[model samples]
Target: MTSEKGIAAVEFALALMGLLLFFAIFIQFFIFFAANERATFAGFAASRVFSVQGIGPAVETSEKIDSDSIMTFETNRVAVARQIPMPSGINNFLTQGRGFSIEIEIPTFNELDYKNRLEQDDNDF
Candidate 1:
């Protein structure tokens, strides 16, 4: 019947809309996760530079990551902080400035101390 066909078309349209909305949400979440991964990698890379080169070079490298991220490093400690930007409406209702922070400690190396520890362990065995 004509009425039956109309009802079926309406239901299919509604279902299609729902499916599209779900797909959009999935894509948004994927982008968010990718951004997070990049931020984390940047933090670790900056920390490595700080440990190997020094604070100045590390700070310079971190500055290239993005405007939303912050990096700081001292003699033996490095820290990176990042903020995730969400849609303006969602940000207003939810907690503002959602972000992550990472800190790494650079180990100090002392050849004499290491050698002494090794000898002590050898004597104990």
Candidate 2:
């Protein structure tokens, strides 16, 4: 004497649980996509400022840009963008006097004998 009413209720509960799981996953994916997009846009915006004003002034501008002043995503996006200059390798090349300099070897062919691979790629190729 089993009726189908209990079976229908059980099936409905299972389907509802599955729907909730799917919604959770979708929301998580949406958050990740938004974060990645923000990071990318921040990188480009920071790069533009760097290209225009170089590293020191760009850092200063970022500090001056007042995080609370703007409610837009771009303001919050590049909050830590100024740290790129001091990233280990380039620290030695930057002096404290507000200018950045990197020794990009402008080499002719065979200039460093066997060690100018980077210059060859840039200048020759």
Candidate 3:
């Protein structure tokens, strides 16, 4: 009877540990999804800004880097919050202030034969 009680306690302890681990992973993935969506928005915003106004002709060299700090639209704090909590005691101790960035060679002016197909589609209608 005593052995049964000990085994039950052990099983419950193991189950609790596993449950906690699963919950922690679930929470991390949830936050990852949130960050991904936010990043998509930020990328679209940056692209829109450059596609219309362009990436040059107004650069003070410090104004357009597309990072979280450079682009205010990228306000997702996941990169800041999702730090690996180890290897502490250094200059970057608690946080690295890491963030996402968007850097791409934005082709323009009929590049890739990508004409305004919408105008042609409108004629069909």
Model 2, 50-91: lDDT tens digits are 545555664444345422121122322233322122334334
Of candidate 3, the 10-residue stretch with the lowest lDDT total is 75-84
Q: What is the lDDT of residue 23 in candidate 3?
A: 86
What C-alpha lDDT values do all the predictions have? Answer: 0.65, 0.44, 0.44
Instruction: Give the candidates in order of lDDT, highest first.
Output: 1, 2, 3
lDDT of 3 by residue, 1-125 (tens): 99999999999999999999798767756655665544445444454554445545212222333233233222221111122222223214424543322332222333223455766677889
After TM-score superposition, what is the CA distance of residue 35 in candidate 3 from its true location, in Å?
Answer: 1.9
Q: Which numbered prediction scores highest in lDDT against the true structure?
A: 1
In candidate 1, the residue pairs with backbone N, CA or C atoms under 3 Å apart (3 or more residues apart, or in different chains) clash, namely none
Per-model TM against the reference: 0.65, 0.45, 0.50
The C-alpha RMSD in Å for every predicted model, in order, reads 4.4, 15.6, 9.2
Error of 3 at 68 (Å): 5.1
Query: Candidate 1 residues 16-114, lDDT tens each?
Result: 999997987687577667666666666667777776777777767766774456766655545556666566654555545443233333333445666
Model 2 Cα displacement at 38 (Å)?
Answer: 0.4
Question: Any idea what lDDT model 1 has?
Answer: 0.65
Q: Candidate 3: deviation at residue 6, Å?
A: 0.8
